[model samples]
Target: MPELPEVETARRGLEPHLTGRRVIEVRLRRSDLRWPIAHEVRELLPGQRIAAVDRRAKYLLLATAAGSALVHLGMSGALRFLDAGLKPAMHDHYDLLLEDGRLLRYSDPRRFGCLLWQGPGTLHPLLRRLGPEPLGPGFHGDHLWQLARGRTLAVKAFLMDQSIVVGVGNIYAAEALHAAGIDPRRSAGRVSRARYAMLAATVRDILSYAIERGGTTLRDFINPDGQPGYFEQELNVYGREGQPCRRCNARIQCVQLGGRSTFYCPRCQR
Candidate 1:
């Protein structure tokens, strides 16, 4: 699944092509993606100008007067921008025809992604409870420390909680934990405030660096131009289980924590 940096990359890629453009047509190759693409989307989108492309957590929002179209790129989903004449592949499920003769297309091999709506001045239920974006002003070390208090979850699991700090998915969480010298298996409730502060800063730094590098490379994800992300090569842990740690040459280890693969350096992280 595309996480925060990946989704944010999509938002940035689409912003220029979408903002200020007229939605000349709304083309649906199918009626549903993950859930049924909202029925009102067809009624609301055509003829409306795209005001902006924004992101909340992992969802991409296409803002317009009618409402904002919220998109979640689940596993194996990609959004590509193309010239109007190009043909869509079999997985291409949605498109927004632009006045500039461009088309923003969505394709998902697994069809787990979503297309939903948020009416003006109201929040969508999908987005309402999301914690502050890790990259946003509301998130920081102390806030995370407060949330982790009394929680028995693994520190990594707590960090991955969307309600604690949005968008710190498995990959980034492992890397951030590794960077902060926090064992992924550490109990969230037992972590010191100073350590949580370091963890928070590490998350912000890793994610910011990821957005700059075009997001972690995933088999199903690509930039709007079809480019693969370059950040995977920079990862410290995530998929490097059984390999030597970059910092201390300690062998990296892996375990299942919170049902996601947890990677860390036993000697360096604790």
Candidate 2:
């Protein structure tokens, strides 16, 4: 699945083309995606102008007067901007015909992505409990420290928790932990405040840089322009099991933590 940076990259690519444009049509080729398509999408979205494009965690929001359409580019999903006259491919799920002779297309081979509704003055259930954005001012060392008190979960798993801080997925978590000189298997409650501060800053820095690099291109992720991300080339520890560590010349190791593959350099990260 596309992480926060990937989703944010998509939002940045889609905003200019979508904002202030009227949705002349809402083309839903199917009745559902990961779930049933919301009725308001086909009923109320046809005539509204997209006011803005925003992201929360890994989801995208296309804002309009009637309501906001929430989009999740689940595994194998891609959104593209194309000429309105183009024909749809087999996996092309939906299209939003714009007034300017362009269309925003959604294609998801796995169908895990979703198109849902958020009425005015309301927050979607999915968005309600998510923690502050990792890049936002609200997330910092103190926040992590507070939530981590007495928690025995591995630090890497703690960082990947959406309710703790949104968008620090597996790849970035491993890289950030390695950058901060912290082992992925360290106990969340055992990590010191000072180390937590360093970890927090590293997470912010790594995520900001990753977004700038257009996000990591793992599996099916690609920017809205159909380009793969450049950040994957810069990875330090993630997916480098048995490879030499870039920092300490130690062998990179991998272990399962919270059911996900966790990677780290035994020497550099400790």
Candidate 3:
């Protein structure tokens, strides 16, 4: 699935082509994607000008007077800006025709993504209880320490909790914990406030840098312009199991945490 940086990269890439442009048409190639594409989306979207493109967690919000179009690019999904005359591919599921004669197309081979609507002033359930954006002001070290109180979950699992902080997915979580010198299996409640401060800073820095590099391209994720992210080339430990740690010369290790693969340097990340 596309995580925070990848989703943010998409938001940036789509902004110029979408903002201030009116949606001349809305087309859904199928009835559902992960869930049913919103029934009111087509009816509410056309003729509405896109005011902005925003991201909350991993979700992308397309602002319009009628409502915001909420998009989640699940595994293998890609959004591309194409010429109006461009032909749709087999996986192209949604299209927003723009007044500028361009089309914003959504293609998902696995159909796990979503296209939904949020009525004005009403927060969608998926977004209502989400924790502070990882890149936003509300996600400081103190905030994380507060949430960690008395939590026995593994620190990695705790960090993955959407209610504690949003958009620190498996890859970034591993990188952040490694950077902060924290073992993924440590209990959240046992982590000291000072260490939590370092962890929080590491998380923010890793995510911001990944977004700047166009996000990690481990799978099908790409920017809206269809460019693969280059950050994967800079990875330290996430996929380098058994390889030498960049900092300590110790071999990296891989373990399964919450059913996801986690990589860390045993000597460097303790």
Candidate maximizing lDDT = 2
Q: What tens-digit string does per-residue lDDT give for candidate 3 at 163-239? A: 88999888899999999999998899889999999999999999999999999899778788989998899889889
Model 3 clashing residue pairs (backbone): none
Clashes of 2: 0
| C-alpha positional error of residue 102 in candidate 2 after TM-score superposition, expressed in Å | 1.3
Q: lDDT tens digits, residues 59-152, model 2?
A: 8999998999999987778899899889999999999999999899999998999999999999999898899998999999999999999999
lDDT by residue for model 1 (153-227), tens? 899999888988888888999999999999999999889999988988999999999999999886767989878
Give the range where candidate 2 is weakest over 10 consecutive residues by summed lDDT.
218-227
Pairs that collide in candidate 2 are none
Off by over 4 Å in 1: none
- In model 1, the number of clashes is 0
RMSD of candidate 3 to the true fold?
Answer: 1.1
Q: What is the C-alpha local distance difference test score of candidate 3? A: 0.90
